[model samples]
Target: MLKKLYLLPLCLIFFVPLIVCEKILILPDHLKNFWIAGVNFDYFSYYKSKVLLILVLFSLISLLYRLRKDEISIKSSKLYIPLFVYLFFIIMSTIFSKYKDISLWGFPDRYEGAMVLFSYIIIFFVFALVPKIKDTQIILNSFLISSFLIGVISMLQFFNLDFIKSYIVGKLHIFQLQYLGKVYIKFNPGPRYVYATLYNSNYVGSFMAISFIVTFILYVLNNEKKRIIYGILSVIMFFSLIACHSRAGILGVMVAVIFFAVYKYKEILKNFKFVAPILIIYLLVYVFINTLSSSYIGNKIESLFVDINKTITNSTNNNLRDVKIYNNAVCLNFDKATLNFVFDNEKIFATDENNKRVSFKFDSNKNEFLFENPTYSQLKYFINNYNNMPVLILNNGYDNLNLIKTKEGFKILSFSGKINNINPVDKIDVKGKEKLGSGRVYIWSRSIPLIKNTLFLGYGPDTYALYFPQYDYIGKFLFLGTPSILVDKPHNMYLQNAINIGVIGTLAFLIFILCYLIFSFKAINTLKDSSLSTISISIFFALIAYLVAGVFNDSVVYVAPLFWALGGLNFKILNN
Candidate 1:
């Protein structure tokens, strides 16, 4: 029975490929289009849940078979305290939740507590059971092969290679061509980007970032022959990353690179005399190739490096073009610029019916600008009579809604053409007023009051969004950006977990991160094997990258390939 353990690795190799194949097999159809569900299967349909249940059952059966045959030890304990906390919250949440029915199970819009619980459990299981280092190799090999195949396909699509396209289209029924499909010709001469088995460019960027880190780690450990092969793949991954045009993904990889340098700080200095010139040559080569690339690449690089301070003084428009300029310019002068633009520009200028001043706001980011009219804008016609005396002129100078100075000593604008007696700016109108303008700091601020309510057992997983609005704004800006957008999950994962299961859950999650850090640090110290050391170090760096990136994006909340890579590595480290 113990001998069968060897077969387990082979099974994993095949199993990993099968998963990859499943993704590839569905690509042509799912990649091009999206659907809610089948005609018979509506929202919160049982189909996806049933499939997950089957997989869980199969895994359990496999474990039992191994245990009965004495092929594997099924030693287990309450090893997942953090997960247990999450489960605890789910149950607690069932009682106080405004939407308990949806919270306990699945929702019409998205997954419920039970489904999220399983995601946590499955991840924890994979981390605890999957063996170290070897499993990482299997995953990496699968990624490399899968990415290469997809890259080849995208290239074939690029040249209008009709026969190949038709052959693939026929094979994959769902895939249709529109604007060069996954690999746009604008990026390069061939398949410039690798959408791979994912639907969106952002996913492609994320996958490439993780794969590139893996390739770099592998290259550092590879023999001469392997080095050449992996090195070429690394270059391919780099181009693929650039083609995705995902700023967050690029930032994530950059963080990983910085971590790599920091991890090797001592070694780097010790060998600086020998390594300095080699590093210089690599930099030179990279720059030379970048220079020869398309104008788009050159422009993007230039845009990345442009000085923000010099650009902000030149503009006031808040359209996408203006916003990009402003975003770059405000990099150094955010607060001052926002204030000047707001107050000086009369960003909130409106007039009441009695000719009193009302309020409004101007918000701009990238291509999106929010011009919220609390009151005044230009009227359609000139000053003709007192009856039509009031008008609104937005910064763009358009009057769609009625703005009036009322005799009731208040300035008001009816969202509709006709006036409504109800006041829209009442305290009840807004959400999360107490924590407004604080961004992620709202989580910390709001948590203090919530903990007083339930010190031992708190709210539930994903409960932050519902409770946050109870905290009113603090007379500043509205929560309009990153932290506010991610109100779905608390901006801080630690705080979110803590609020859900009280202090215990929060501590457990921290301990897991701490444990992984300590173990990886020790591995770096004791392992004289360069290959093992490089991979371990890279994994450590990648984890940090994800954490930092999470500050701005809801990464851990979603199941991206990066999470899988990180979990697999953490599992490997503990087992090793």
Candidate 2:
């Protein structure tokens, strides 16, 4: 029974990547984010619910053995300290959380991070209980098999069979592009990227990067014949990452390669005699691949900075550059209206169609308009005239101008921008969508002050939506063009932590990262054994790459198998 239970995790591991495409009905519909698993027999809804069921089973196991105290091991001790610290901070923050419920149990009360942490605890405790390297091999093998399958399936999706997307969506996916009665799995962006059951290409890129590093490390562990197989796997993972077209992931791979070279310098440098021939062969191979490909892969690689500025503008009906320009114009008009309010002693109360008031006044003493400052006059001399329109429009579109009078105030017009015909107070109904996808730019801009306000304790988990308006929802006038009227998660994880948990969580989180780096570095440094050294080096560099990528984007979090795998690997080294 114990062996069977141990094998259970491995069993699920094989199915993790495959289960994402299966059909299942969800209870609340919003539980879908965590449900974006790969192809599987079970529907996403079933898998999500099953995670809870598995948690219950594990909880029972913990309870049944709660009275039976097992001897502690070196690995468990090292792992538990950090785990406990994370939990302690989370619990303490929750008590003081403006969003107490989410802080304790996750936003939907599912405890995704806690579940991940629990899984780590289970693996560590089981390792201590069993004290077997064979168990570690089981988990690693499962991951290797799943990653191989995922790579193959992702390649198939790039072929655009339409069957894959159809089978995955289970229903008619209107969001997916349909061409010639077939659902095309390419974004409208130039050179169209494929997002296989994954929500974004970046996710695919990150997954591939980690998989490549693991495979490379495994290749290092293998004997001659097995090394060839792992070598092929590395190539496949690298190709898949390139196909994803994630610049950050590509940069991460380069970082890993550089780290590998520096760490393995002596071993590689020993073959200095054949270096010139190897370099010549590599150049020839690169040229051959570039010439053979029909896709502009060579050109794209050469010109990484594809001017997406034209992309946004060309898509919009108006001369305005794109959705960004439109959004900024709205913000611009709102800011101007706010100034009108202050000067005339009129209170500005602009809202969306929903009648939710959107404007707020900043502290008058510190946050004054630029025009009110003496510097504005000097700066204005460089340009024809300085207008306080939303920054979005002036930068992207809104070249021509006119003015009109409304019941509330004077309305400015620009021929190059879309006309604002609808009442500014009417809400445009932008709820429950990816508010912005240009990545962390807007979040960094808006979340700074919120972080400062909660300098010590933060507003609490999931309180950004409630408090964002209090700071800078600035109506439709200022034209900052932030996506949603009701702002939520601050996009960046670091900012989100500072805003939700306050100074303590930020410090603790940073400390956790610091400990991870220091321990991994120490392990790598102490490596006398070749296999141990390789594994430690790979794991350390992979963590570095993951952290670098994660700073700009959200990650797999605790529920992700990668998290558990990494945690288990670190614990093994600490114990060893």
Candidate 3:
């Protein structure tokens, strides 16, 4: 029973990836809107939370069973001190939070509340306590197999072979096929970015990025026959990572690769004959894949420069010039009567048989627009200027409109007459870059002011959303386009930590990571001659990759567990 209980975590490991499709699981109507601690619990979070609870329970049971038998004794380590300190700070932040519900249970959209954080800590402790070599092997192998399956699915999705995706979606009745379908329509005539079992393409990229590194480490540690297998898996993951079209993932992988090469220079030199051929083959395959999808991949890569330029220019000037133009343009609204008067000779305005104004409401679900009697020029102008304008002219008054492209023409997804509550569209920058990540520069700039008062204790855990609106400089201007948009996360995990738990908590967390790095680096240097040293080195660089990627993405349900689990594994290996 004790042994069986210890293996339960391996089951948890397998189900982690399945969370992507878990939404498909059918739940009763009443259960669908289930609430836990005042938070609306979705099926995905419920399933994951249950699994974690069971795992923690079994781990405790196993520990108690072992203690009774006098077979094993619990040991204390200083490595856990910082983790405890971090947890203490997190609890304090949660207690002092203005939005206690959000801090404790998280937002409905992202359920990484106190419960999830505690589960992560529990998982870390489970791995650290049960660091048996066989268990470690089981966990690592499970990760590789799951990631390979995910990569294959993503590849199939990319190639438009929807059999697997359709079957899975069918099984998960609630899963929205349109979420994936809409990506193709949104970026028509371009390669469809595959998200696989994850929520988004960037997430898939991050998963594959780490998997590629792990496979490389496996290839290094294995025999020649096993090397061939690992090599093939690595190639598949590499292509999958690129196919995700995540700039941060790509940059992170490159950084990790460079770090690995520099750290293992001598080993690489020694194995140059064996490594050179593989490197050449990989390069050739990468080039072939890039050529096949050059248009899609090339455009994504080029956008990095556009993003950088937008950031740089925004730093110097506020980019308020375009905002002023947009405001002035939107404020000059021409009503139906006014439009009819302006085009009195032309039959542009729609009217009823009684000559009354015909009211129109944009259907959010559909992707086509029908003009009652619009001229070609008027229709074209509306389509062209729709996204830039804060509010568009309607029969009643100026209303918000989102012009989305369709096979027929541009259609409005949203239309509302109330200007005060308009869902503002993302504005184009002075350099013509549209939707520059919700004006991240402006958001970050605003975050600085928020941290001024909450320097030490922070606003509280998961309270960034609560405080974000108050200091949102760009949000006020852009609210006309996306009034309902939630600036919940800073998009930078470092900033997220600073705002969530303050400087002390953030430092405690950073110090814990720093200590792990120090110990792992020491282990790598000390065990330089060991066959498994490559694993240590690989994990170190992989963590670095994830850290760099975290600068662009906050820690989320999909990736954070894997990081913490691996960190635990690293600590265990170092201690042993």
| lDDT, each prediction | 0.43, 0.47, 0.60
Residue pairs clashing, model 3: 24-172, 423-481, 424-480, 424-481, 424-482, 424-483, 425-481, 425-482
Winner on TM-score between 1 and 3 is: 3
lDDT of 3: 0.60
Write model 1 residue lDDT over 300-322, tens digit each, in one string: 54543342222333333221111
Per-residue lDDT of model 3, residues 401-467, tens digit only: 3433333332334323222322333322344223465356556655666676666787776667767
For residue 506, give model 3's deviation from the true position in Å: 1.2
Off by over 4 Å in 2: 1-4, 10-18, 21-82, 98-131, 162-164, 168-170, 173-192, 220-222, 270-406, 409-439, 453-491, 525-529, 557-560
Error of 1 at 193 (Å): 10
Candidate numbers sorted by lDDT from highest down: 3, 2, 1
TM-score of each: 0.55, 0.62, 0.72
The weakest ten consecutive residues by lDDT in model 2 span 375-384
Q: Is candidate 2 or candidate 3 better by lDDT?
A: 3
| Candidate 2 C-alpha lDDT tens digits along 1-576 | 574463454335334434443432332333332222211123232344245337435533643353254522332344356556555555565677655544544443123333343444454344334324435555556666766776675655555543455555544354344333443323232233445444456666677767777676556544446556766676666666666666555556667767767776775566444334444543554455445445454665543334233234332211111121122123222211211111122222324324444444444454322344221121111011124432111221212222222344434443333223333232232221112234234445555666666676766554554555423322322233431233444545567667666766667667767776777676677756665565556666666666555654443332244644555555565456
Taking every candidate in turn, the Cα RMSD to the unseen true structure, in Å, is 11.1, 12.1, 9.4
Best by TM-score: 3
